[model samples]
Target: MKKNIFKIFAALFFIAVIVSCRKEDPLNVDFSKLNIDNPVANTPLDTWLTTTFLNEYNIDVIYRYNRFYHGDDRDVAAVKVDKVQPQMQTVLEGFLLPYRKVAGVTFIKKYAPKQFVLFGSGSYNPDNSYTLATAAAGRNITIYDLNSFDLSDPNTIVNKLRTIHHEFTHILNQIVPMPVDFQLITKSTYLATWTTKSDESAQADGYVTPYASSQPGEDFAETTTSLLVYGQAWYDDRANGSTAAGKIALKAKEASVEQYFTVNLGIDFRALQREIQEVVRNTYNYQQASFPYWLGQNLYKSLIVNAAGDPIYSAFPLSTPFSLVNNNMKTAIAALPYGLTYNFMKLNFTSSTAMDIEINFNQGTRSFISRYAYTMDLDQATGQTKFTIAAVGGNDASWVGNANLLRPAVQPMLDYLSNNTFVADWLPTGVDAVNYNKYGGFYVLGTPANNFYGLLGQ
Candidate 1:
């Protein structure tokens, strides 16, 4: 009985050993039957992006909406199909190309972010603040708010380019860290909640912007980006306007940034700035043939006469029935008696120094237009703006009577024109239909109490 039990136990142990040593057959599956979806298809935009970004610089542009591109926690929308190209074109022209030209193609290829991800709407925060663009690990960049991009609008163009410059600055700093002294300059001013601070307040505290006051890294990025994007004039203006300590701090920061680029990157910071400024100027050339807001709309002229019934200076015409003719040009068409419709006054910018002001009249019998050409001079030394009538009627003798009637009204314009130095002081307040407010006309520069004419659009 003992021998039989030993043999049975030995057989059980042998069976267990065989089972453990035995190998299982590999699982067989057919990849042919498996369904696979290609997320990124070869479309025209894809080919263009591949050619423009990927092929050139090994950078990938992901315009198609993917939640994974944005973090899972962030709720952002995809960029509209149509807005993608214009916005990208503006960015390439205004931001990247400038850097490529100044910093060199090799420098950008080496330092530029490897991937750019686009979104249509801004990334909204719990505090109601929206993010325009951001970069991660110095490799991926995400730009938001493509839906409202307008290539023609200077403000929009500047703003979007500003974001790109700001983020790119971060990427640059990642490669070569900012000077340690930069943080010490505004060490006490750094705040986590920078949104509460206004730009003016931040400037007073030795920061370029409120966001710059958040941290030293952000401060460096803001200063560099602002200098490059807004140009030296804008930087100087801001620095000049700041408080004494703020000015010192700004200059110190500026010196540090300039040194970093020069020493580390072998780049002339000012030359880079000029290159960027030229690109921006070409993109949004303010000198293009476009009318100022005050010109194309109906203006109410107020005439002021002395007690002796002599016209001292007539304010702009009081509710003139004239309508702008050739909206693109400075000619106005007014309805007159005897079925006569004529350009009341055509203001022409003939040359840099000359402006031709033409006045016309029907007079019930015959109609004639008189041209009063003026040669303007701006006194750069005294900062005084002046304009004077160099010639009257432009050799036309037909409407001297109409020119006489229009002289009083046009004189204030000439006087206002004489103070052309004030043109720089005019700020854009807002827009009303096709007309813009606070650019020109009477309401801008100073109060109506100072000037006789008010540019009101009806």
Candidate 2:
């Protein structure tokens, strides 16, 4: 009887132990701290921010704090995250309390897309502890030079947040996906070209960036970044400097961004842009609030596609530069500078091949040649004039006003019968150019001295 009693007690105790051990709690599970930040080791970082941040932004974050490298015993700290779980009773009460009547699983399945990351101390990178989070593909983050973060520099902190959110926006867009046609631009050329080429060059060729020239996926991602993080104004400033080739690529990209945000993402890009500017103004307390973006926008407007969705092209078609001698020469020019108009083309052609010979201040009609400047071009085969004449320079760089000052000022007249046309045939073919603005225009003075800014007038 004693043995039987002892066996029963042991069995009961064993069952109790198993039950206790099997009980799972949401807060205490040990997460990996593999990145440079190593927040897991720095604090008892729980899943507190998980549920909290998501309720506000519909995001989820995953964390991994400590990591190790393979050979030299040095650490490469990068951030990578995967899942988003809700914790904190306070957040739950506020969110769930309102919807207490509905089922819990239903809510989880409906409204939110969880946000999570794996932050680290040692990177899986080649260099220092600099961190980069790609919210688009392979949803991972690698933070470098861990010590570099001041935890100060309000600007830096804000940028970091912005970068993370920017990548997150990309991922969401990718999943939902923009039109595949948007991804088709420059499908053959995307690399790290954005950093390499100047905006002037990009605009000339109809692209937003040299990198954007590489492929469509990159273009799409860049377009999303341009629209969301920097907003239309910043995008405009950056794009205004783009070359003719860049402009074409930019147009495709612009259309994609507009479609994605308005039709797909279900957000107002214009209102969002305003909201973004407001946030920046309020957060940083800057007097101008995106001073660079707004400043660049003025010049950008001249390029075409004003940030407010306006078209500045019809007035300046190369054919009717001043008024067509005919439309054939205008047809072959391909593209022209931004914001130019028939009213602006006040010059007339005096020589052959469509050039201008016009009076300056009503004093003398000087003979000049330009496809755009001299709208009327003498057709070699037909013995008739077709192209029109227009002014190629800005207020400061007009040939009649400051004929001797700037080199690019006379490009319209000079390039017509000169070597400028076939000067660059070595580049990619199938590229027929028309209406491209010169790299720059000349200005004679600012308070009696020469000064200039941007590609076109402000």
lDDT of 2 at 195: 60
Off by over 4 Å in 2: 1-51, 54-75, 78-113, 118-131, 136-147, 150-155, 192-214, 285-289, 296-458
lDDT tens digits by residue: candidate 2, 38-74: 5445343444454355555454444444443222554
Distance from true location, Cα of 73 in model 1, Å: 1.1
* lDDT score, candidate 1, position 208: 86
TM-score of 1: 0.57
lDDT of 1 by residue, 317-410 (tens): 2212111112212222232223444433444545445555555455457776655666644332222334566756343463365555445444
lDDT of 2 at 203: 53
